[model samples]
Target: MPETVLIVEDEFFIAMDLQLMLEGYGWRVMGPVGTVKDALLLLETELPSVALLDVNLGRELVTPVAEYLKAHDVPFAVATAYDRPEQYGGEVLAGVPNAGKPTDERRLMAALMQLTGR
Candidate 1:
């Protein structure tokens, strides 16, 4: 089966772009959920093989979602404009791979591949 990736990002265009890119790479994309609440809702039903999270989701932080993923042993990386996501997300996000803003396809894919053991 193809690997699944859940995407948690707020920006509409960026989220869609990621969906397209991941699909192109033959991975099943779960979501580009815009809020922590929505992301959590999705997680309750199904767990993706890996996840890509945006550190800041509008006024909310992605920390809660990250915490859930970590607790479940689901691997994930952050995509953020911030140079240091840990500054915004606190210690839970420290040392996690960051794909950065504007989404470097190569780096993001590398991190995802590593996380999923693909």
Candidate 2:
């Protein structure tokens, strides 16, 4: 079975494009949810095999959502433009795989595949 991937990004067009891309690659795509609230709400009932998370959601940070995913043992990659670990709570996110903003489909898919051991 293809792996299921949850995507949490605030940018509307990017999110939709990612969804389509993942679907095209035969992976089941879940929410391109734009906020921590919505992403958390979706996490309440559905756990994707892996997740692609944006570090910032509008004015809010996605640390809480990342924490939740960690606790659940859900593998995830950070997708962001920022390079500072301080931007993500002082190295808490250091060494985590990053998909980077304006995501390169090849890199993103490779990161997710590595995380999922697929």
Candidate 3:
């Protein structure tokens, strides 16, 4: 099966662009959604080989989403503007690596590759 990815970013263009990028690499993407709620719902139905999560989903936090992935042993990485470890509630590396915003093709792909170890 093709590798699947769950995207938890809140920006439309970013998500769309990421989808295109991942698709180009032959990855199946589950979401590029704008809300934490939407991401959670998608998780209930399916799982990806890796996840790309943003730290903030509008007013809500993405920590719970990160927490969920860790609990399930599903590998994931984070992309956020906030660089400090505290901003992520000190969860960086628990399962999520820090991939900042304005992410490029190589950086995002490298992070995803690390998370998948593929």
Listed in order, each prediction's TM-score against the native is 0.95, 0.91, 0.90
Give all candidates' CA lDDT scores: 0.91, 0.85, 0.81
Residue 17 in candidate 3, Cα distance off native in Å: 0.6
Residue-level error in angstroms, candidate 2, position 74: 0.2
Better of 1 and 2 by lDDT: 1
Pairs with steric clashes in candidate 2? none
Instruction: Compose the digit string of candidate 3's lDDT tens values, residues 1-118.
Output: 7899999888899989989999999999998887878888988998778898877777877877777777888898877767674444555445456667988888888898888777
For 1-118, candidate 1 gives per-residue lDDT tens digits of 9988999999999999999999999989998899999999999999999999999898999999999999999999998878888899988788888888887789889878778767
Number of the predicted model whose lDDT against the real structure is largest: 1
Clashing residue pairs for model 1? none
Error of 2 at 105 (Å): 1.3
Off by over 4 Å in 1: none
TM-score: the better of candidates 1 and 3? 1
> Between 2 and 3, whose lDDT is larger?
2
Candidate number with the higher TM-score (2 or 3): 2
Q: After superposition, how far is residue 35 of candidate 1 from its true place, in Å?
A: 0.5
lDDT of 2 by residue, 43-92 (tens): 99999999988888889888888888888999888888877643663355
Model 3: lDDT of residue 54: 79
